[model samples]
Target: MGQEMYAMLNQDQRSIADTILASHRTQSTTTADSCFFIDGQGIYVMTVAWTGIAASLLPEGRTVHSRFKLPVPILKTSTSSIRPNNEAPMAPCYALNAVDILLRDIMNIDAPFGGKIMILGGDFRQVLPVIRLANRSELIAASLKSSNLWPYFKVIHLHQNMRTGPGEEEFSKSLIKLGNGELTSNEDDEIELPSSYVPTLCNRTILCPKNEHSLLVNEEALQRLPETEKTYTSVDEVECEDGDDITNYPTEVLNSRTPSGMPPHKLKLKIGAIVMLLRNLDVHQGLCNGI
Candidate 1:
């Protein structure tokens, strides 16, 4: 794991890792690389990244394992990492198949079941798999439901919302209805915003349809704040991996990118100011964008 990832872990997660590591070092057979056994306690703590998994399936990947003393390579699959994003289609089928083969051939598991334990988490309603240049059918096809592994999943529904504020059930139901596509107004299929959705002087937020609109609103709001403003400018650079520097991508080009994500070339804020996060940097930590 990267230092940043380790730093992001909460105390509970850190304690869990520490306890397990201590337990594995003394008595737990220490089956995995990160495992430790302590006296009579046995625990395995293997943390692998999606990119690492992809690298492991290569011929050279297996060679590295052979060179080292590996009892058996265990792989944990997270369906969230496989979901298609806006830029990519459904998870790479070849890579998935390779993993299945590795489980069967290397780990000695039956076909299809990748490892001894598979833990999957994420809400389907929140963000459907992205499929560009396609219709509803393609979008659905790119989702986990369309995969052969869907049948093995035992879907669990969470009914309670412990975080709900007073009278938030009604608001929650309204959102569910909107998500269900049950609130369309006419043939054009435009859903009317709630009466309270519009921005007001006393409202803490202004929900805009796009990031550009949001930026304008943010600037206006910041100016209205009764505090001294401080401006910070970002230094943009061309990278060999992320993008080619053949033309030395201009600062203007970088600034034109998504502000909701990729950091801005310049940022302005003030003490006691409010701002929205721009990405899912840490969900468990409640540090993701929009929160």
Candidate 2:
């Protein structure tokens, strides 16, 4: 990781990173190219990278499932194929519990998470475990907060909103209140929006629920724009996985498929065209998703 990115970390993020570092000073693992970091007791500590994308970005990082080999729809009897790890953000409670069980067995310690110093970061208010056909009660039961290991962990509440831009302080505060159900509303439960935000709503952009719709709208808008369109085609490739033949799938076939959150293979653009990012390329430089 860049020193500048580390320097950009706010007080809350610094505290979390510091807590991870303080676990073991003997040695630390890091990837210079990755945008995130988690450090602990040298080679023994298991660091759960935020997502598969984040893991791919890191040199040593791996997803909780990949690192532990935890089964999909993990059960109470499930145990990790490997031993040891910590610092999992946005992991479901059941998943973490499976790790805890594995660690205790490997370390031969009768302690929570085999005496590992864990730092779990995430907002319970947002993106809880998605249990199909599950009710609200079942949803809450699946949360990390409801885990038996929850009491063993010392919770650190981060109050800082690091990504809030200039003049967005009030908007940020409102968001926090909204999440907490503390925002004031009228009898109809409608909170009035600020007049200053009207200009933002007026931007010449149409939100579409699917890629096909977005492509149609984009094409229409591009044709209407008074300029020559510049077409950019991605150098698409197909790298077959182990046990899979390369000839099984053709390049043209792969290019024709546009998965969610991915730009089309043949991207057309015009000057002054509005664009949004689908991935985090350089978070420090603000080239992230939805930029």
Candidate 3:
């Protein structure tokens, strides 16, 4: 971090950093397992984020999955790959539980994170774990508050809205209320935004619950555009176990598929149509995931 970055931090963030630094200094001087505190076992003060974009913005930050080597298709009994191992922001309860297990096993201490000081941060009102095909009950169950260890952790409240200005405070409060489900909803299960809020085309991005709904919106927008439409189709194929292109899965089947993390086989576009990048090609060049 540079002087400019330090100066950019709000009061709350600065306070958090100062506390972490003080703890790091104390841990560094201690004789008990100094290797784990000072060196390779893990960073004295590590930062973990749920998304790669958030991690990229932080100083020496890494996504939880990469930093912890979390297993794919993680289960109740799942463990990370690292031999030994944060401001773990927006961490799901399951992910935290996995780390708790890892720390206990590696440090040979039957305690939460081997009794190491952890500063967990996140907004429960925001997004939770993304479980495919999961219902509302399942989603709630996966949150950090639902975990048994949630009670052991001390909760600190930071009430100041350091980023919001005087005029914008009410709007910010309304947004918080909306997130917390405190706002009244209509028959459509939607709450009206703040009266002062204005939606602009350039600054707004529409989010849909399902991919098909998104595609529908895109098609409708494309039709309304006063320009010629262009259709591009990707080469569709199914590779067999023997490394041969097989006709067993027809082209229509492949073309009709719109699986998560995959682009549609047939891509449609028009002049002045908005689009989003799905993967990071070069962050330095402004080409990144979710851009």
Candidate 4:
């Protein structure tokens, strides 16, 4: 085994990825620790938002993404936007700087993968790091750019928005100006929206003040549609070694603990119902997770 490993590590070595798999194939006990300190067994390709990573590090195990362990390798998430709030676990109360903590961890990455690079990227204009009781400046201060470790980072600026289509350069430029702080209205950081952009009908984005308001408005609009309603219920199960535990899941508890953004187990739909996908299964054809 030693000779084989020596040959594997030296002359006839495979890619680092393959070597890791080889170790797993041989049931190397240290493989798990050498990779990560978590039960990353079936979590082959995990993706999480920046704030999701931060929230997972909480000592209290109040992780909104996955069960908390410690010191997992960082990887770019599916979308890799790191745009504040998107899929992140929002924790307003648990104070202390989260971005700083995440950066500090990068600064002290231990051996085996200590040479790993951490790239932090995001647009502050979209959403500042929102702390529970923080003000505007405080929110700004919570961003990774505000951390002491930020000096060591090599910044990369993307001047172009590749997603912008033809005849939308002006619109894209307006967005760039907004992001760069070159464009602003006299109002409280509010910009004028084109009258045509605001949707009074279907097939466009509509901004609402609150979730409840959005839902209520949608419900009202859908009422006018002459489609029959169909209802579906969800199956509830508890994860436990004991077979008996699975059936013991209380409906109330299951419903309460159901993830916030997950499609409800019980769902109602009509023939002409307007439904938005929550995941991007295709990109080339513009079939993505969001809209």
Residues 1-291 of candidate 1 have per-residue lDDT tens digits of 456655775655555445534433542222232212111023232222122232233223211122222222222232211111111112322333333455446556453533333223334555554444768886676565666655544443344444567867877777777866777687787777766544464355457999888878878888898998988887776667655663777878876776545555668889878766644354335443444
lDDT, candidates in the order shown: 0.46, 0.65, 0.66, 0.44
TM-score for model 1? 0.49
Candidate closer to the true structure by lDDT (higher is better), 2 or 3: 3
> What residue runs in model 2 are displaced by over 4 Å at the alpha carbon?
1-46, 53-61, 83-89, 185-291
**What is the number of residue pairs that collide in model 2?**
3
lDDT of 4 by residue, 1-291 (tens): 545654544222334335434544554222132331110023132223334333233222122222222222222221111111222312221221233344335546432223222222345556554455768776555555554434544333445564677877887777767767787577676777555433575455578876656766777777787988888787766778998776677766786553535666656678888776554444334343444
| Among all candidates shown, the one with the greatest TM-score | 3
TM-scores across all candidates? Answer: 0.49, 0.55, 0.69, 0.45
Question: Over the stretch 11-109, how does candidate 2's per-residue lDDT look in tens digits?
Answer: 887786676565545322221111222322133545454355445444455567766788866765777877222334356678878877886788787
Return the top candidate by lDDT. 3
How far does residue 125 in candidate 2 sit from its true spot (Å)?
Answer: 2.2
Better of 2 and 4 by lDDT: 2
Q: Name model 4 segments beyond 4 Å from true.
A: 1-113, 184-189, 195-213, 232-267, 271-291
